[model samples]
Target: MATPPYPPPPPYVPQPPANRLGGKHKTVLGCGGLLFTFVLIGAIGSACSPTGSETTKKVPGPAVTVTVTATATVTPAANAAAGSPKRAQESAPAPAASAEPVTAKARLSNHVGQQLQAAQDAAQAEGFLVLTSHDATGGNRMQVWDRNWKVCSQSPGPGTLDTATTIDFGAVKLEEACP
Candidate 1:
């Protein structure tokens, strides 16, 4: 066999693509995703804030701390008949002595069949500041998420209650039936 003057060309081999997207395209997409995440987070934070104010202002004056204090007085029923409701009276607010829950008169609303969070909101709206809940079935389960629980029963159901009173709510999981 005679040797060729030039070496034979290497056999043709297929090569997979290095990348479906270029570095520049990947970077752009990553940046877009990051920006979207930041915008989402900011929107959630702004929406969840307690107040609608977008910014806070600094006043050049003596810093004063405001405290809310209240007291509730329930008068005995004029008619000592059974099932009669007593009236609640509000006295002058006293100075804040401690971190104890303020005792004010808050009307209690019927919270049965409502979400725990809604129940709490309603109680607060009714002027009841202090509120709490427990497992209605005596399962000893704690309500970790207020929105996931439903109010089965409430203490001192639907009446004028003292703000200082700890409204006890018996709640069950949203999927569970109230006992």
Candidate 2:
């Protein structure tokens, strides 16, 4: 082949552009992208997070107090002889003694040797809760039936004058086979 024109212009080789971004500029862009991704993820997570609807707010005005009083009215008798003292006396009801609310306190009682149901009933009647424990020390287990179980001992023994709301009872089968 004869020298082709300009000797094929010495194979063209590609070169990087002179105005390309520097290393520092690339690093700054990468960091900014990562920060934007993290912020976006955090915002989405917070939007989807579980939260309660109720908001606690303080009242703006002074607290108001209210008092209520009750009154009793007597109804006149319809079939009595016109203006009769006997009728008036019979129609008027006697005034009730000052009514006061009564609260019953639990009085620890001797429940040992008593049936579990009876003990529980007695305790509940006195406004107390009952906690029963099995006494299965000697290979004897408590039965599911309350009546079949007998209390062997009690905590805070009878007449202690302590207002414990809950009384614990140690019980076993009624056969008395267990110590």
Candidate 3:
């Protein structure tokens, strides 16, 4: 048997110091580069701050001006009464009168037609206004009165004296037909 020959080894080439950065040196250089970048950014920011010139100053915002004026012409005291009506004077508001119903000496019980008259008389005596009177039901008439003897509202409600008390003297009327 013949012996086979072995192949020769390939030639070897030496590598140069391919790495430019060493471990600690690389860390220091990276830190220095970062510091330089930060300083450059800070310088740019300082340059961009307002310089009080038209281009560096902020644009003027919308200018606004507001003015208000009021004028009043005073009327004389005597002339003020000319526009108001006579009735308005009569109806001049009074202090809220005692809400407690006024007591009547005459009992309104069994008094239908006479209810209005009784209310009117009671109101007159009490110094209230008697506006008008009309029949509300059989034996019942309502009378209306203002704070003064001025009639305001009336109806013929023939219930009783107690019932009429609540009617505020305004529902008593002196009419023949019941409303």
Strongest candidate by TM-score: 1
Candidate 1 vs candidate 2: the TM-score winner is 1
Worst 10 residues of 2 by lDDT: 54-63
Estimate TM-scores for all models. Answer: 0.47, 0.36, 0.24
- After superposing candidate 3 on the true structure, give the runs of residues whose Cα lies further than 4 Å from its correct spot: 1-4, 11-21, 54-179
Per-residue lDDT of model 2, residues 57-118, tens digit only? 22232222334444555665663557787877787776545544433344466777777667
lDDT of 1 by residue, 48-154 (tens): 96443222222222222336865555444445344444321123233444455534464566778887887787676666667888999998998886777888999
How many clashes (backbone atoms < 3 Å, residues ≥3 apart in a chain or on different chains) does model 2 have?
A: 0
Clashes of each: 0, 0, 21
Most accurate candidate by lDDT: 1
Worst 10 residues of 3 by lDDT: 52-61
| Deviation (Å) of 159 in candidate 3 | 80
- TM-score of candidate 3 on Cα atoms, chains taken together: 0.24
lDDT of each: 0.71, 0.63, 0.42
Question: Model 3 over residues 86-160: C-alpha lDDT tens digits?
Answer: 555555554343344343332222222334344455534333332344332434532233111222334434332
